[model samples]
Target chain A: MAAMIERINVLIQYKDLLRELVVRDVKLKYRRSFLGYLWSILSPLLIMIVMTIVFSQMFDRGIDNFPVYLLTGSALFEFVNSSTHMAMYSVLDNSALLKKIYVPKYIFTLAKITSSVVDLVFSMGALFLVMLVTRAHFSLYMLLIPVVVIQIYLFACGLGFLLSAANVFFRDVQYIYNAFTTAWMYLTPIFYPIEMLDKMEWVRWIITHLNPMYYYIQHFRDLVLYGRFTDAAIFWGGWLFSFVVLFIGLFVFKKTQDKFILYV
Target chain B: MSEEYIVDVENMTIRFNLASEKVDNLKEYFIKLIKHELMFQEFLALKDVNLKVKAGEAWGLIGINGSGKSTLLKAICGILKPYKGTIRTVGTIAPLIELGAGFDMNMTARENVFLNGTVLGHSRKFMQEHYDEIIGFAELENFQDVPIKNFSSGMQARLGFAIATMVKPDILVVDEILSVGDYQFQQKCYGRMNEMLQGGTTLLYVSHDINSVKDLCDHAIWLDHGVVKKSGLVEEVAAEYMNENR
Candidate 1:
């Protein structure tokens, strides 16, 4: 054994702790709710119906089988949104454990991100059934799921790790994150498409360039509605961006997590 | 370094910010952020605190509420990194910092034990192997399937303690976790603590329970206002502490 320990080694050791915590999070959530896990898919369905109707009028391009189109975005976008929001609150929520044990503090944030992805799996199944019934063209590109899932997981974990750790010290990060996610929904092409952004001459391309969510929403749009794999540039670029954000988030989180026991 | 001392905290200093008195002071906020001055130190929780705990040693830290006892334990556990100084420990460190710290109330007692055991540094396989032992120690055999939220504070504490000590942490850092459980459970805990001590686990106990300290500890340290006032044999130090306060 080396005298100096690598962080990666510690992270690997604590992976089991992360899994156990994620399981508890998922089980604990549905324990009391009347509908339990069904709400994962049902809520998306309700939102998708309303969004399809709303966006169809706004864009005037009325997608055939628009509900399924809306479902694709709703299901995919929910994973990103829920993961970030849950991650922001996770450290605060797990304060009791956090102050006691010194496992990677980021594990709590990752656990929230993981649980949201599990719910995302459910949301995807609901969309798949809708697509099958509607007879939409499904293709081999759907196999690109492993790529998409990994990208979204890294993307959400990065953002969640950053926001949750920030929430520990800044206190206002929680409120700001809540507001940012809601406002961020309109800014992303979830309900709309790339065509809308093309019309906005005043909005800089820089905005989408900076936001990783834009790339993810685009990949989601490509996979489900268009029955195509995302552009190779997007698949790689989005992952690279997520990767960098994860490192940055980890640096910030490790530096500040010690202060959480007091603030939280 | 290997003579028997399991814990070595040298000049450990912990600083934490107090909740702001002024909510609308954006001026203060920007100034603090920009200055980031070390001297602007908002609150000093622990300062130059040093100690050593040898193998099979049961040492207790006694102080009034908010006297930095918990802060010291946390600093030793690496939950709070000291602004100055180092804490080097041998073997695994299990901190029973909060009674139900890692537990989710909405999950079953059984569910929490596995998860809680993991947080205390036990592998899931280790948990699988020791599942029966942990539940047996907690005396939660019949109610393993029930959500922990329905259990009383004492039951929760017992479960937390059982899972925490199950890993046989080389150095156990406990902070006021004993107060939550009833007398019987506390007795069970004391027996467990004694067993761990006999097996050569270093115990770092932080509590306001003077008698508990007097009974279990071979050495006692009195922490007042983030600094140590006394550190010596249990009887003399505890007597001095009692006299100073009285």
Candidate 2:
């Protein structure tokens, strides 16, 4: 308990450092690029167009507002995907700084996730643009979007902590995570309707019940596309998954961080 | 735990495990572990080391290459954890372990000053107030907008040193950062360090240049092979160290 409070105190004391690091990450990401920050919105919009063209015919379950449906799901998943990937490399990328200074080790991972959240907000503009173009339903429930995003942020932070700490010891975590995310993206139903697996009830059940991302993406779609609040189970499940993963991530990271200087 | 000592390290031991074989990936490491084939040779970087520093005192750490001089500085900065002991420090620490460690080369010099300042735990408002002072001290007034990558190495080091000493920290831990710039800049850095010392900052400096160490530090420690060979006044330890090298 004392350690936990001390950690929080450190976080508070270094909040300014965290902000600067996030700003640096966001800036350096777009530096020297011709399109610069435009790519954040454009890349997702372009992916939605291609995926809509290719997968629209194959998995057309007569879902209304397909572009809105696809964009909402893909955008949320992309946040988790990109944030974790960036967080995974956070420690190793800052190895030089880590070896010299005493900044909290988890601060690097936190900064990466925060910067990716900035990108997520930008990509969200693309979602709204697609909604306007497609003339999708608009409801008061849209304000709940930030709540879902915050939940997803917590979930990604947990995974970020776990992966960044693991990466310090095993350089192969990056490659393995790359392959895992590809499989995870397919499993999350970003481009397809979950009901398409109706014939395989067990598979559908596993994806809906077991996968944490499914709850977040589903809640996001419910709010943005369907104009309704998520079911109680999913609403609570999203929070549960986020806190549990965050707890586990913090536990593992604290256990392993002391050894990080030796490896990094 | 006394208030007099600004830095206290007691019987600290830092150990590293040198993996007998290089295992870069998870699969190979797990396989070796399952088969009990993973071997490690224990290496002690610093064993049973102890040091105490009072406020407003300057101490120099001198040793040959691989003699744990850098390791000791790192341990004091809390970058490396001790395997078998405790380290307690009072007050803020400004560690210039290596200049430019926190710099983003792609960022402009002006941006880096803010970034590095925040990394050292200064508030954004404080950085804003001291922006011109830091820039002026580094003497890069005309190059503020240029990316750090475009700056020469000496320029980068100067910016790093300037930002690090901008505030008088309670404890300053420097590790050979003064070796990068030209002789004139080195003198300038020494001058700034001297000013901070006069302001009652405890300094722990590591340098191979004995003459400069003697000039800056009142007391010194000679570390040889992770052990304290001799430690006393600057003149006594410096003479012993020079004689042994001769």
Candidate 3:
């Protein structure tokens, strides 16, 4: 408990530095592009359009509001995808500064996650535009979107901590993660309906019961696309999975961080 | 942990394991570990070192290349953990070890000032208050909006030094940053160091210029291959170091 409090104090003390790092990341990410910040919204919109054209005809399985459904899953998964990838390299990228100064190492990973959160917010603008064009119902349940976002943020933070520390010792973690995320996206019901796996009951059970992203994406689709309240079990399950990963990530990261300077 | 000593290091040792082969990937490392084929040659960077610095003292560390001068400074600044023993330091430390290590090349000079300042643990309000002073000190008032990548190496170094020394830190760890800028700017940096030293800030400085070490430090330690060879008055240590080199 004392250790946890100390960590929080460090976070609060270095909060300003964290904000600066996030701003630098968000700015540099778009500085060279002609579209600049517009690409945040446009990139996801374009991806949604292409996916809709290619998959809509094949998996039209009587699902209502397919674009909104596809986008909610895509945007949420993209947040997890990009944030983890960025965080995995956060420690390695700042090896120069890390070797010289005493800034808390975890701050780099936190900044990457925060900046990706900022991008996720902008992508929501695209999601909203699509929802309006498709005339999807807007209900009070949409207010709970932030809750789902917080849960997934915790989940990604866990993975970020784990990956960033592991990357320092093994540079191959980044390439392996890239391939893993691609496979993970397919496993999650992003561009297709979950019912399509009805013939395989065990796979459906595993996805619903074991996959953390499935719960998050489903919670998101519930609030945003279906305009209905989520099941209490699903909500609690999301929090449980997120906290489990977060604690494990923090554990692995803390155990290995002291040796980072030597390797980095 | 005495209050009189602002910096205390006792029986500290730093070890580095030189891997026999570069096993960067996990698969090869695991395979080597399982087969008991992984070998590491132990290299001691600093062995059983002890030092204490009182408040308001400027101590110079003189050594040849790879004598573990930078390693000791890094250990004191809490950047590297001691492989054995303990290091205790009081108050905040501003490390100028390799200035501009935190600067993003693509960001403008003005943005880098705030970014680097925050990295050094200064609040935004503190940076905002000292923004004009930093820009003026670095003499880059005209190029504030230009990306730092376009700035000459000297200009970037100047900006880094200005921000780091803007506030009087309780402890300042400088590692050969004075060699970057022009002679005039080096003079300016020395002047700033003198001012801070007079204000009761403890300084741990590492530099190759023996003349500057003798000029700026009241006490000095000569390190030979991770061991303290001689220490005491700056004149004696500097004379002995120079005599041996000649």
Tell me the spans in candidate 1 whose CA falls farther than 4 Å from its real position.
Answer: A1-5, A57-65, A204-208, B1-4, B18-28, B31-42
Q: Chain A structural similarity (TM-score) per candidate?
A: 0.89, 0.97, 0.97
Give the per-residue lDDT of model 3 (tens digit) for B10-49: 8899988887676778999999999986777888899888
Residue lDDT tens for model 3, A22-122: 99998988887899999999999999999999989988876777889889999999999999999999999999999999999999998999899998998
lDDT digits (tens) for residues B150-217 of candidate 2: 99989999999989999889999999899899999999999999999999999999999999999999
**Residue-wise C-alpha lDDT for candidate 2, range A21-43, written one tens digit per residue:** 99998888998899999999999
Better of 2 and 3 by DockQ: 3
Put down candidate 1 lDDT per residue, A212-254, tens digits, no spaces: 7777767776877788878887777788888998888877886
Best-to-worst DockQ order = 3, 2, 1
TM-score of 1: 0.90
Binned by DockQ into CAPRI classes (incorrect, acceptable, medium, high), candidate 1 is: medium
Select the stronger candidate by TM-score from 1 and 3.
3
